[model samples]
Target chain A: MEQISPFKRLIASSLGKKYLMALTGFVLVGFVIAHMLGNIQIFLGPEAINTYASKLQNLPIAIKWGFRLFLLTAVAIHVWTAVLLTIENKQARPNNYADEKTVQASYASRTMPITGLIVLCFIIFHILHYTAQVIFDYKDLHYDLNGEHMHDVYSMMVLGFSHWWVSIFYIIAMGLLCMHLSHGISSMFQSMGWSNEKWRGVLKITAILIGAVLFIGFSSIPVAIMMGMIKPIIGH
Target chain B: MRLKLKVWRQKDQLDSGRLVDYQMDNISEDSSFLEMLDLLNESLVEKGDEPIAFDHDCREGICGMCSLTINGIPHGPEKLTTACQLHMRSFKNGETITIEPFRSKPFKITKDLIVDRSAFDKIIEAGGFISVRTGSAPDGNAIPISKSDSDYAMDAAACIGCAACVAACKNSSAMLFTSAKISQLNSLPQGKPEKDRRLLSMVSEMDRSGFGNCTNYGECHAVCPKGISVDFIANLNRDYAKASVKNLLKTIG
Candidate 1:
């Protein structure tokens, strides 16, 4: 019998595909935490966050673009593998069960794909709204404060959240991202082959807590802004 | 009681099956689901027509030979009950029950409601057993396994190899079935020597069999006649990962 390559075997197997998703998902998850922390700098007032944003912009091109490229590749592989697995799963059952019923899977687990797709859409919309500055004006990038012109990221964030619609969109997307994380976090361990009966409960609880923290941490910025807790920097 | 059955009929594995409507009258409420089918077959035989063909060996339900999808459920509507144990009384007098064979690429239809599940046997043959000496009977208590481990093993051992999990799964994945077998042997002391080998080979065969990947959908446990939990799946996955890592290290070292 002809032997198949181990490398081919790993990615071709169901477990292999799951491992890819779990690994990539963890990377994205770490990115989200870092992003939340960075975004929260706005709460420290204008000079603190603007300085921070400028520092990021001042980083060497290799470091900055390399990280962005890595993230983009991870996202691409994650989404592509997911689509392939879903197609294969669908083909497995040519005919749907007549009297379908859900017994044990949570709503979050079942809706992973839907929630994931929504998160993807939100990511693109977010880039357009803030990074590309194509959706709506948050603040003038060339605005001069203290006789020095730089991107007014703090004013941009405040202006973006000041609009009820944008804040609502961010809040809703973050909520779905929480749901996605809750299911993905626990499942990631399972795919990595570390889960067992004893750890199942602990893992599930931890996943929920992580989801809750992320939702609160990310959503707080918009909520605080909408409620007039954080105002645009005057005279900037 | 009278009941309407939308029974699936197919000539062979390659043929597309259709749900043929049949009316069954005077079915006793006490009759088991398979027994009701027997009654319907008797009527069809009397009329010189082809009887609905299905697989059932032990009407008592332990054999797992009986397989049917009654009203979109793998083992009828009852939870934790096989078709052979499901009584006609569970359904209303005039209810319509849709009966179909377990549909999955791995499980192909041989006839009316019977599907070829030998793919499961192939998977078992891959590495579902521990090597033992062919000698006089050994003392059962000699191994001295922990009570908790023994019980956990038994929970997995209870699986009867029915494909109900596959039928119920939206993806028709056999993660539950495959995992049960893995966990059953993985928990026992005697099977420890071959644990890594067993997991890798069995999973490889499973992937080759064209079964779908599990998305952690709990439908498999919900429709399981033996009520196997999805926890074993997590254990199996964990073991598989460890085995792969061990195997890779062996190559590098």
Candidate 2:
């Protein structure tokens, strides 16, 4: 028999793929929480957010790129394994029951792939809109915070979300993301075998709570901006 | 009671089956689901028509031979009951019951409502056992197993391999069954010797059997006749991970 690489052998099995999905999902969930925390600094006013954004930008290139690469790899593995599992899952049931019914699976659990795909699309659009600065150019939105020149992410967010359509789209995406997390968070624990009957109930509630918190925390910015509560910086 | 049953009728493995409706009258609510099917089969036989083909043995429900998807549920609407144990009283008098075979890529319908579940047997063959010496049984108290371990193992041992989990899963995954089998042995003292080998081999065979990956849907447990919890699956995942990593390290070091 041919000797297979351990990593290849791991990826080739159904259980192995699940482990990968769970681990990568864990990374992505952490990233989402951290990302939300950073973005919510906008609630602290313009200077606070501008300084925060500049500090992130001023990170050593190696550290910045290393984090980006790590996150990108995590997302890539998460999505790649998910697609594989979805395809296999589809093939597993070649025929459907005429009167199929869901028993105990939640709506969020059943629609994981759909929600995940939409979230992936949202991530791409978000990167292009903000990180890549290609969708709506915020390159000139510079701020002078205490005479320190920095990218005025605060005005850019306010201006970007000022568009009703953009805010609406962002809100919708955030809602779907929360829905995805509601199931994914709890599911990752199960996949990792860290969950059992004793902790299942608590884990489920925690998952929902985390999802709710993220939805509110992330969506509040767009909602506040759209409501004219968090106006753009004066003389921007 | 009178009822309408839309039972899947497949001639053979190659046949494209369909739900053929039959109106049944004079069915006793006391009869089990299998007995009701037997009544239907008797009528069909009397009419010189081919009776429905299904698998059943030990109608008391321990045999795990009965495999029918009653009204979209694997066993039936009743929780933790096998098809052979489900009484007709569970259904409404005028209800239309749609019965189908337990469907999955590995489970091929050989005929009406009878699928070939040998894939499960293959998984068991791969490693679902301990290599104990065959002789007069050892003393029951010899191992001194802990109460919690014995209870947990007993819970896993209750699985009868009915394939209801596969039928109920949206992905048609057999993780529940495989995990239960793994947990049953892996938790015991006798089975610990080959734990890693058993986990690796059984999971490999399961993957090779074309079952879908588990996404933690919990549908399997919902329909499991034995009420096997998905916790065994989590245990299986945990064990498999440890085994795989240990195997990798052995190869590298």
Candidate 3:
């Protein structure tokens, strides 16, 4: 309309951030599923997981690096956009009522970034324990499984889960991921303009399915290792 | 019938407002809600006291200027009707109605039951229009909007901008009000060119104006005199996303 008030620009641009949040979030969900699937190779055997890891590493070195770089960009853009939008929402109001409660958005929608941040921390720890070790020759830590010097992939995962705090963190972080995905998936559809009245119900069901699959798939890895269903390969 | 009412009284936006009690009697059931308030004003005038000032226009549901919040429900205990059209017959004789201004940080209180609604105008000003010039009245049949699409768009357009959505919402969310405008023009071809720009600007203005995020309580639609549905909000989210992609593509290409 009138070009006088520059305040309009700030508001108009926020809709952009909303799109950034939804699209980046949807792409990240795909990453989460793939990451969990990669981790599940531990259940197969050390040779299976190491072979999988080596193959992932062997793929056009630049492309592998490029993919990681792309993932980082997606994560950074998503967080920065979310922060700016949150600031705009908060600054518009000076004094809000104490009991301000939202009536419509699910718990996941409200707590996305908080959960997202947690998942981010989990990713860092995961890289340190597994990827970092593979990359840099860190101190080889292991548990005495039948007095064997077995620091294979299976042993590393099982030993890591044996510690109480690490297992607890994974469970909590996955819970957040599930909560984030529960709302994030549905919201992604809304953002993409896929909200036909007839299909809203279908989209909702699909989101629930995706969330449930990731939750169960992620939680199973640590639980199985902690339960000792998968053992360390000795003297590999 | 006689009744005591706890009406909010304030001199201006800077004045501290409070619930001031007053009594009125011999009011008729058939009298409109405005008439009941008129009788209260008459009594106050006779007593040499300043009559409680409020906002009202058209005295019909169509204008949406009546800003009374009776019994915690916007526009009183009525459905799809503004306060002016609400009749006293809906309430008992001895009932003391509690009236408050819509509590939005953007809607500053000008006086009792009267707040400045310029925030809505600001929201509209922040890109609620297309680039078309007002040359003359366009023919209705020139731009053929689908019957179903037209109905849905009109349903959103029916929003009177009363700020009841803000008043009725626990979080003071403007989702219904904001989304209605977004969806109304978004469904039609005339609104296609600036669809993304319009939605992006309005939502930013909404957030900038200090309105809370929609928590989906559905109270806004329930208390709305227009009975606008929450589905419009979902439509807003949908269109906003498309606008973003469209904009991004334009940037890259």
**Candidate of highest DockQ:** 2
Cα shift from native, residue A68, model 1 (Å): 2.9
Q: After superposition, how far is residue B157 of candidate 3 from its true place, in Å?
A: 1.6
Highest lDDT scorer: 2
Candidate 3, superposed: residue stretches over 4 Å from native? A1-12, A98-102, A133-151, B1-11, B15-62, B66-101, B125-145, B166-179, B186-253
lDDT scores of the candidates, listed in order: 0.87, 0.93, 0.75
Compose the digit string of candidate 3's lDDT tens values, residues B128-244: 777788988999799888899999889999999999898777556787888998788878899887887888778878877877655344678778888898788777877766665
lDDT of 1 by residue, B89-195 (tens): 99999998899898899888999899999989988999999999889989989889999999999999999998999888878898999999989998999889999
Q: Top model by TM-score, which number?
A: 2
Q: Write one digit per residue (lDDT tens) for candidate 2, span A141-199.
A: 88886788999899999988988888888899999999999999999999999999999
Candidate 3 docking classification: incorrect
What fraction of the reference interface contacts is present in each model, in order? 0.67, 0.87, 0.19
Candidate 2: stretches off by over 4 Å: none
Model 3 misses residue B112 by how many Å? 4.7
Question: Alpha carbon lDDT of residue B231, candidate 2?
Answer: 96
Model 3 agreement with the true structure over A32-86: per-residue lDDT tens digits: 8898898888878776665666568678989999998988888898878767655
Better of 2 and 3 by DockQ: 2
Query: If you assessed candidate 1 against the hidden native complex, which CAPRI class would it receive?
Result: medium
lDDT of 2 by residue, B90-173 (tens): 999989999999999999999999999999999999999888789998887878999999999999999999999999999999
